[model samples]
Target: MALKAAGGHGGNVHAAARDLRRPIESLLDFSASVNPLGPSPNVLRALDEGMRLIRHYPDPDSVRLRLILASRWKLAPEQFVIANGSTELIDLIPRALGIRSALIVGPTFSEYGSALHRAGAKDRHVRAARQDGYRPPLEEVVDCFRSGRKNGRRPEAVFLCNPNSPTGQACDQNGLTRLLKEVDRFGAWMVLDETFVEYCHELSQLPSVSRYPRLIVLRSFTKFYALPGLRIGYSVSSARTAALLRQYQPPWSVNVLAQRAAEAAIRDQIHARRSRAYLRRERHRFAKALSSLPGLRLFPSRANFLLLELPKPCRAGAVAAELGRRGLLIRDCSLVPGLTPRTIRVAVRSRNDNNRLVAALAKLLR
Candidate 1:
């Protein structure tokens, strides 16, 4: 079977396990790029304590979690809009802002395009070239905003994912700052998705979004906090934009356990620090190991995953299938725009798991 699209996003081991009639844990999943160190103990303890609270509805506004985020970021609580996931906020933006046209930087997250489509908005994609290592052209985007495309009006909004998915490329702070100024000049909204920014904290633009009236910064606890199942995420923007987004979001979109878990997760500075340090060390080692494998070109990544260009004569789908049958699941990039049939993505996992993946590829590729 063809690998499901969206790079077979992490936590898909269940469906594959069911088909193989094996336990999920038996399958080594490297498709999703969650923290290999896993969730903080404090987060798990918070979840256990929150079990009793499930009988009651979650606070419709997620005031407590918002307060934690506000304190951490030094932003007013009014600047926040917590959501079930950043995906919810992505879909809500076009409708909430009544945007008719939007430009998306890609090949990045597929959800941005799908969400805009659902809002009945025009989607314009400017793909980053492989020759450029998939870095988005900030100058070109500024020009697009300043001068409307030949066939259409200027986009009312633009979407960008930092340390972008699938490709694992990110724009530096200087470049992003310049792009924001251009977006401001055009009087359009800029949506910066920083879901993977925790891994590369220095590059995050979270601190400046509140100052930019037309900029919205999206973040998630799923990857960094290892809370994908909880689906906790939020956005930071001007108070007016936050309020508008709130009006469009369903009440209690964030659940009781998720709120409690995230509340505890954010307080564990030790866990966050340790995770950062570990990822830095392990990602380098893992990337080096992947490099030694024949016919695989590993792309530079600041996130928890690496995108690999498979050797010629190797197809992503075929490789994904071969590895899947051996209980190792990876992302096949055939459907991800701007990628070739030989591209595949694998998450940076534990040393043992990473070695197993390398060995599996060694055997397959040889």
Candidate 2:
């Protein structure tokens, strides 16, 4: 079911339209789950202001941006580690902690496997069943962790993709808390990737990072703030863990423009409220519409995207290609580990775009 070498993290407008002879602007991308509304006006102003500082080296420490994030979370600046993107910090975690083996809950983002492998760690991917709507069961994960220790060895790290990618299911906080304590007993780290948690802030464990020394929470501005091009994300952990993550990072990993953009983006309360409100209303409307489509099984999601499993006779890659020819790009989830060829993922976008996508999908299904 692995359709291509690159795993199913979509939003590849450039590559999708490259050989189609179609303009990128003409493509309606329901592939990448990013905010349909923005690079906030606040971000635009910050980017413009950052232009004057391009000639100077960015502050390697990212002090100003960290301060802003700290204020929002009510945590000290030392508890946060800024990076080029969450990917950088993801890779850093295994290396910084000298992790030898790890457990990853899948099928979720491929980067966790790739990053851990690159850090020279052996990672066992435990699949979360589709029958359960792709949500990883906490009891199963705890059992696996405990069972592995019976061999006189245990994984040094465990990764959880909150509101997991490809399948937008998340673990309950109390369950996660109990699991965190279990991991603590074995002296292992729990890497909680909440990249899309901003869309559902009430589910976030970001505030608990200070309480759990073994927890490392990864967050990004790329999806929520629409600053993917700028590439700025940060990690939240205890001050000591944050320092270790920072130590391994190259100098000035966050550029001037990215830092400025994040600073402004975090402070844009008006846009944040609007984005959340819009996502809530539109996600419900879109989900209802999608549910009415024949032969499609839509998984529950709290993030700004939905995971769809098509009828048995259909395949996602083929459907994706058909939609692509019509300037609609979607993610074929067949390649993502733990998923079948019938699965595909699409972003929750604007009303018009969502309707267009539904129309296109409906026509193709017919």
Candidate 3:
């Protein structure tokens, strides 16, 4: 059994964010997943203006941003609840639901478990076999819940990642809806993390949520909008579920600038369209580049990031350390079980940068 220590290292992103405060020009961070062509021109300009409003209490409601989101999504503004970041929202679900027990997709973003741990919940794993392309058997996942229930393990929370982390496979829409309905029958709250869904293009996200009160769809501007530092994301649920979450939402939870930037981003269809086009083209190109490199195992991915399983009997940590020394950073997946040090996750960056990574790996392996 691989040791699952305190997992959420927060990636190099937390480090980069910390380092940025001290002033630096460029940092090659394929460690964090965000849209390479994000925080569009319009939002950058709007942020310049919104920066001045830092003096007043940001509208506690984050009304404008929600309005824009609602308009684009064609949902009621009241249906959207913003947060510090999707992370905050993820953490909140485990909190607000009063769920003392949960299950998460293994080798996924560790924060899901970290949040459950902080909330004093028992976190169980339905490991996604790496050889299986890290695709959890949805049927098995559902069965885990059913069997657990029969065994008196009525877990209240099931956290899912669409275009899931570390391993980029996504459950089809029908599969997700079916899974949700099964879990709902058991009275569990299904938290769907769609942080990478933007990269999936036309994959349908209309969750069982529209008809079921137990489903919640979580999205973040951090990924596709390329605004991780701005810290903005929202949740979609039935009116009742939205209201329940609204009651717990912190006043002015989203700051003035993040709100303005997110509102502007949610409304900028051009940026959204262009980023999708770029990722669709670039992800395939990058994947092909990585596959041709010796000793690298590439998996199928429909997202902006690629989860790579490196040569066996190796420590991914060492690869990461070597890359970091060369000013290039990627995710070392050794900490997550069912994944080994031979596993690394890299984001699809600008074409030149992606080539640089491919070149770096080639040279290192040689």
Candidate 4:
């Protein structure tokens, strides 16, 4: 199956359970990189309280959620958009902008290219080299743009996932500012995916997007709040871009339960703070354990997941399959170019789960 199809593959929590001969309730999946600690007590309580109102359509406009997100980002309600998930908004981006050409950063999300193709986009991909550990090359990108200037051609959109996916490598604030400035100059829009930024406090680019006119930052409650099932995500951008996205809107795209749960989750400061503390500690321990294993090269991660390169002759599929048989799941990333068959990604979860993964692999690698 294609990587896009496989996305919803390993995370079929119940089905994966059945295959392993375990009760769904007894299984813990590390396949999905969702916050192992979340869907806070507050969000749970709100869902319980709001369960009776499911008959009514969600605030059709997602007015309440947008207002909260807008307020949280110090922007007007008109400058925010709520979608079923970041995936939906990701699909909408090309259509909303009517862009025919895009420059996508690879070894990242597959949806960007899939979405672009569906929108009839002429795709231009700059694959990040494993030799460079998948960090953004600002100068190379600028040079590419400059090289294309004589053709009177410029890309319409640039999809940049900060703390980039699969590799989990992030650019510092200075690097991002320079890249965004270059994209902004060529009249290209920056679609900054900050879904994993909450794991890295000072390094987050959410607040920085406020100062750029053409940058659109996408956020999700799925990864941070463990709300993937609810399908809650939103985007922050200029009033004009936000309005354009809304103008091409899908009606009541987000549901009532998701809206309420997310509204509660966003306000749950206690939960957010505790999650940060947990990731800060557990992620360190987890990364160290993975790196200490012979033949695994663990990259630095500001996100809740780590990107790893295994020793030669060890395929990611073989590793993922072995782990899957043990009732554990990790992302097999070899299909992504620039990543060898040895590449795999693991999510940060509870101590017990993380330890299980480390121990399981230590035995297998031997």
Write one digit per residue (lDDT tens) for candidate 2, span 227-336: 88888899999999998888899988899999999999999999999999999999999999998999899999989999999887998889888888888778888888
Considering every candidate listed, which one attains the maximal lDDT?
A: 1
Question: Tell me, what's the RMSD of every candidate?
Answer: 1.5, 1.7, 3.0, 2.1
Which 10-residue window in model 3 sums to the lowest lDDT? 1-10
Across 46-100, the per-residue lDDT of candidate 3 in tens digits comes to 8999989998999888878778777777778888788988888877777777889
- Cα lDDT computed for each candidate against the true fold: 0.88, 0.87, 0.79, 0.81
For each candidate in turn, the TM-score is 0.97, 0.97, 0.93, 0.94
Q: lDDT of candidate 3?
A: 0.79
The CA lDDT at 104 in model 4 is 81
Model 4, span 1-366: residue lDDT tens: 111112343466766666677776665576668888878998999999889989887887788887888787787888788998888899988998998998888767878888899999988878777777777665666666777787866678888888788678887678778888888888888899888888775676667566778899998989989999999898988888888888776898898999999999999989999998999899999988888999889888888888888787888888877887877777778777667778888889999999999999899888
Q: Give the lowest summed-lDDT range of ten residues in model 2.
A: 1-10
Which ranges of candidate 2 are over 4 A from the true structure?
Answer: 1-8
Best-first order by lDDT = 1, 2, 4, 3
Model 1 clashing-pair count: 0
lDDT of 1: 0.88
